[model samples]
Target: MLDQALKNQLAAYLQRVTQPFELVASLDDSQTSREMQELLETIAGLSAHITLRTDGQDARRPSFALQRPGSDHQLRFAGLPLGHEFTSLVLALLWTGGHPPKVEPELIEQIQALDGDFAFEVYMSLSCHNCPDVVQALSLMAILNPKVKTTVIEGGAFKAEVEAREVMAVPMVFLNGEVFGSGRMLLEEIVAKLDTGSAAREAAKLDEKAPYDMLVVGGGPAGAAAAVYAARKGIRTGVAAERMGGQTNDTMAIENYISVLETDGPKFAAAIEAQVRHYGVDVMNLQQATALIPAESEGGLVQVKLANGATLKARSVVLSTGARWRNVNVPGEQEYKNKGVAYCPHCDGPLFKGKRVAVIGGGNSGVEAAIDLAGIVAHVTLIEFADQLKADAVLVAKLKSLPNVTIHVNAQTTEITGADGKVNGIKFKDRVSGDEHLVPLEGVFVQIGLVPNTEWLKGTVELSRFGEIVVDAKGHTNVPGVFAAGDCTTVPYKQIVIAAGEGAKAALSAFDHLIRLPAAA
Candidate 1:
């Protein structure tokens, strides 16, 4: 299944495999099982020191479990190891084949000290490049400790499981069946969650009435920047966000941010978090802001209610909740999501290199995705629902200049088509011609629009027609002492540097608000 170049790379990687490892694949009379067998056989064929076995009948399903000299933990895969998960499979096999876990003693001690039996269920897409780090981390723990077990479920393979979990994205870690963290997470974060016995224990220690000089909501680059700026002013600042990374974590490649030539979403998000924590900013994660209770007067404490029945108070608040990609919601879209249907082209585009893919929507994002993928993939087909392409003339001309790109306007994406756990094509209908057609493509990128994360802020602060918070040049919202920034606000272009600058302005504005406060009672 691998090309000559890829096989050569694999050979070099497996040269140090001195210990023998066995890949036990549970097979059945199913096509998925057949595909899984082919993938495993290809890997096992690369090294003479490795062995493969097909033992149990799993009906139409297939699973993999690794066994070797040192590891006895039951780390299993209920889904095929492909896409972003292929790396996890390789890393798992390599570790069992005697590649000692490359980790710090402190991290090893933390994993060893984890007391309870924890099951780390990681949902991943085969196409996500960043997912391997998270998956390998948890699996490494299972390999080292007997108390911990890891289950790798390919999010695209198990559509029903993904739906039951209400998962919309990859690298979603469920520690004990509860959503512990999402996006690109760090090892210390896993250990930190394990340190807390239960969510109840974590929530029970919070003081809802404790006031802060500034509370920065949202954990994206904007919110993190605001917290850092506020903290530097020597005021009590707390950052409450649904997830610490925001939408920035969904991006795969970023080169536009100033002073940084290149970076990925996960790395940038981690950098933002590290900076915020380094400044002693109190960060409350996994807490959704449900409503805003405005302060009665100047210098009065404002209450920020959380989804978990907790009300946090702050003298001022900065809203930086980011936006999410608008899904097409067509049939097979939810079912085939991450299997072949994707949202972020920057994140999942590289996975489709040298393969044909489809882009739904023809706005700037769609045109940009087509342009980006054209350079990597072998062919590109762009489908637009509107009568004419809505992208800028320059972008449209650039797209036209690409020989590999094919654009179809006034066409609607009807369904994403595939079988046996993968996407193979798409079904669409023409608005003008009233004709239906199918395009053979391996992946789909939906770039319709961005819906701001401001539903909870309705009627609280002044909002635009699209529900985005109204903010001035200084990030000040309509309400007194309340500020907003990032994609959730009226910022013209939603970019990392733009949001970060807006956040800094909001933080400075908030500090100025604090300085002019009335005398303390």
Candidate 2:
């Protein structure tokens, strides 16, 4: 049950609603039924702009047509309001009413009067609760600017689209028909993209450039190492990573990466970046390499074209873009990311010390997080939709050894519940018979499988059936002068050290190719 204060806040938020709707009542419990009436009344009275529509009320038919409440017009909520979706509903009402959220006036002003329509489609896996922040922010922007239409498609449910769009990660944002950003973007940057047409246009212009001797496409450990080594070898090196640090950025801590004892992700990334920069490697941030094709003229160079219309020529290309963590798209998962929800336990576990927590997924990552959190949290509930843990014997053995950790296999999370802007608990359904119940907790960590970021290379590079990039012993691709390394590539063991080592190999291979190029010329 939500606290009285939260009930009041919910009431206030409900007052902002302007559209007719029905709350998709969770049929799982008596407690929910008991509290529904009081909650509904509070929400109805507090909202100045919204009036409730009972079951038999004059509800308008649902359509894609534009329905206006005012010239101050904004979206009104329709459909089931649950978890993070409810927050979106409230924000939509506020935006439609021309009332900005608690954000600064200047920021609000920046979002206003923006021309052009942008649709953001975020592909998220259920195990990745970190993705909701990206969804919520975009949904809020969509509300603030009617020109923007945002949709968050769960990765698991939309397999066709995932394959079609080559969605390999959670929290991947596709803006204006092309992949815009991944992981997360700050509020200011989002505002800038929303408000400034020129800023977006300039960003789209990163594709205009000449060729280089070596181009490392990823910014992870492997890509960084390749860049540094190539720069040292004095091969007109350039790096065109989507973002620096790759999947390592999501890691909470790295205890096993050799010589890095008790290191955090950001710290590790900084070290790699510093080393790469020391060699005078040309680093282009926030630029995505969309396509790689052989040069038209019979030269050793590969032509790399960016989504933003920038083009570059490179003698060799190293593919080190890493994999993305999978997510579960359950209700409330998107609404509470970082507000008591998390993906990487190592990065966020310490914050939950002494608090009750839940970890989803049966993979090695899930078991690892469960074992790690058991030492920190008061209690740990590990939920797996499968019948048993699929992790290694050592990890599972260690997980079983923990007294504080309780495992629930063949159970799926039905919904994430919260009040007052933080995760409070989760509801689960038994996979066999569909019996559902809620468990209260302060946090939920999702640790499912990872998807390699190699879908875009489908026709260009050879990939494993699972979509991992296939590279040879020296990191050379089937295509000459093109190489791959890291989690995105198929060398097995998606560890940081392995990626770094592979990066070094790819750089050396690229150097070898460059050295022989002039003689061939």
Candidate 3:
């Protein structure tokens, strides 16, 4: 099941196993089961401390469990964990075999201290870019806490269960048979959810922090760059974000980044975060900024309030909170989110396999989603508000070549209609004809665009009519000591490289402003 190069790599990594472990597999006479057995045997042959057993009685065939004898540490994989989940399998092996995880010491202790029985099941797809993080996080929790158990389920392998649960998205997490969350989630975020009191404890710690010379309000490429640049100036720098990686965590392939050739969004985000941390920036994740209180005087401190009720003060602030997927405001869209409406085609496309779906928009994102879905879904109806597709010529041509894709220009999505709490169809209007039509489908993918996350800064800083932070060439907002950068600003081209460069410029401009400030009292 694995190539020679992959086997050699696995062999090298297996050397880190410090203790004995067993790969207990449940199998039947099926092609997938045979392939899974071959893969398990290949893995077992690499490490002296590993053993393979085929006596597992799990209800799911072609499934396997990794267990350490004489211990309660155990985790299961209910399908061939290849593709994005391959890394998850490797980590589970190492962690179960007594290899230490890379998490912080405090978090490890927190995981071990959790009381009560917790069972987690994460349903994910092989093509999903965000599935690995959730899978790995749950696996780590299961390995660390004796009371916690986790099972990673491949949605494609269990289509009946996915349909019964109405799981239309990837990385849909369930706790004790109830929905926990959907989409990408980090280890810290999961722990925070379970611990409950962790938020208050975290808020207390954040409230005690001293004012920083430069505080960055985000954790995307722009915020990471700003934090790194500010810290390089020998000033105290801090970053507060809802999540460390921002929207990049949900992104898939990124081939346009300069020099790096190619890399996915998660890896790029991690590299930038490591770069920021290397400069000693105090990175605070899972903190949402709710309000911005400007400084009273030129040299005074600016206070940013968080959703947790804790506030952070800084000498200068760089707002690079970035943007999020723009939702279609039509009726039933909100009522049926995750029921049939999805924003990520890569993550949710497999859930709609053999079913009809609609792609709302004709831009690059919309066209790309349609092309990707054409191979999985039965049919794709592309609706556009413009007269022509805004995608590049090559993409448009490729989309046009797809037999199952239908395009409608000058079309506006009116509503997403659903039945029995699940999406059933979509309504659209032909602008020229002034007529409305409905396309019968099981899912609707909205790829309209992005909206800046600058709602908190409203009335405090100058903003464009589109709600973007208005900044000058130097990345300075109208308010002194307040700078903005990245997609959240009035910058043209919302690319990662451009955001990083703007972040650096904003930091330098803040530093320049700092040097000319009046002496503090």
Candidate 4:
């Protein structure tokens, strides 16, 4: 049941209900079922143009089928609408009543272009704040396209379904009954798989002989910024990336990014892509870079080879290829990733707030993660394989200051333990005692150092032992016409804003190099 205040808000929202809406509820007579039924009935009772109907004893499953007059069921909400997901239910009701959803035009185009029948079965927890976005996106896609159907199922209500699908995380998306991915996914990502006209084909069409004035590699914040900066100066700029947003997209939440108050990974990444496209930058997305060839002379051309047959030559290049998180690589780790196992404390920390959690790796990043989580989470168990923590004195001091965090030295993470598709605890072995211990936790954060995406540039560019590109303050590398920036470079700190600034600098430096060249490049 909902509060009177909430009911009044829903009534106001449905003021201009156009289509006749009905609640086709199918549920057992359990207490939880009763609550859900009452909630749906209450919702239907408020509007003059709305009605309620039970699916009867012979109904296939206990779920809510939202059917509008003169139309078949367009959407389904499989469980009780509790917590933040209540907003999703409200939106669904309004949507069927002729209200437009806030979806991007390009995304709608992609949805409309879908050729085959596809069903989006989204598994989510009621308490998960991030789940609703995926549900809404899929619903809107279904509304726009006849082939795509969607069902938002609450995890707790459908225990059998959750176990069958191995749904361990909120927003676990299953496309046509198979796990597509877990976590906050964007509309573009889902549509990407369905679209036949892939980027590999798109990359093939770009002229290999013609040289770009400036070519930006990597699609993260740095590359996007570099591409935009280069394009603004009226240069023949092209951005090639496997995916847009780079390492920034791997992050969960960004509060320290200056002006912005709060933002999450998927939304932030989507915004960056949208902004880059708005500037009409020649963005070659989903194109992986395999190798880089430096210019022979000062004003000569540098070549970039893609995994595909396409080759791109440029007068100037900006290597903003970002870093990837160092995974634990233990059993069940990859399978449960984004289900319960997670990396990037800033991105996924809030989801585990007030719950017990574990942080593996005792480096600066690990200790920092422990310190950050200590304030929000109930407890933090930090495990380090080495005898002593490798973090700085200040960070170590700050970590020790937190009473809620427990430190375990010379302990190795053996396995990530979970049941019915989600992570619940961790298996660790003590080096000294040779004893294995299992600590129960709601989530696990891996805070090991990042692996820079500079391996491809080993011989062509000067690189540190960690495979990070060696660069000067102005983003100049060992090669004259080539430059590097962001996490891939030997930057002091890896921040999104810092990378973006570096990208801008790299673009400006490339432009300067282009102008100084005697020959037309």
Whose TM-score is greatest here?
Answer: 3
Q: Pick the candidate with the highest lDDT.
A: 3
For residue 260, what is the lDDT in candidate 4?
87
Clashing pairs in 3: none
Per residue, candidate 1 scores C-alpha lDDT tens digits across 377-417 of 89999999988999999999999999999999989899999
Task: Score each candidate by Cα lDDT.
Answer: 0.82, 0.70, 0.93, 0.81
The candidate, 1 or 2, that scores higher on lDDT is 1
- Return the TM-score for each candidate structure: 0.70, 0.58, 0.99, 0.76
Sorted by lDDT (best first), the order is 3, 1, 4, 2
lDDT tens per residue, model 4, 70-134: 76436888878677578778888887877876765666777887888788888877656557667
> Which segments of candidate 1 are over 4 A away from where they belong?
1-127, 140-145, 151-197, 329-332, 346-356, 371-379, 387-398, 401-404, 414-443
Write candidate 3's Cα lDDT for 37-105 as tens digits: 999999999999999999999998879999888888769999899998999999999999889999989
TM-score of 4: 0.76
- Who is ahead in TM-score, 2 or 3? 3
Off by over 4 Å in 2: 1-208, 297-300, 329-341, 346-356, 375-378, 385-387, 390-398, 401-404, 410-442, 518-521
